[model samples]
Target: MRTLKQALLALLVLSSAVADLPTEMPIPEAFIGSPVGTASL
Candidate 1:
């Protein structure tokens, strides 16, 4: 019914909106480096 159609429409809109987001998020500088004595994996 009507509710199912509305749910599908809402999902379509949400998915489209999410698809427009940036594919590559920038990494924060703090996580990119470690202190002089510490080892990074």
Candidate 2:
């Protein structure tokens, strides 16, 4: 169907756009509470 083809095309464009985004996300400040050298388990 024409709608199905349109949907697939839109999905392809969206996926390609998402793939171009920077992969490395910065850690949020709230999650970085531990002091530099210490490990919490």
**Tens-digit lDDT string for candidate 1 (1-41):** 99688667655654565466455733223223323112232
**Model 2 score (lDDT):** 0.46
lDDT of 2 by residue, 1-41 (tens): 99688667655654565466456733333224323212212
Candidate 1 similarity to native, TM-score = 0.50
What TM-score would every model get versus the actual structure?
0.50, 0.51
Q: Which runs of model 1 end up more than 4 angstroms from their true locations?
A: 24-41
lDDT of each: 0.46, 0.46
Worst 10 contiguous positions by lDDT, candidate 1: 30-39
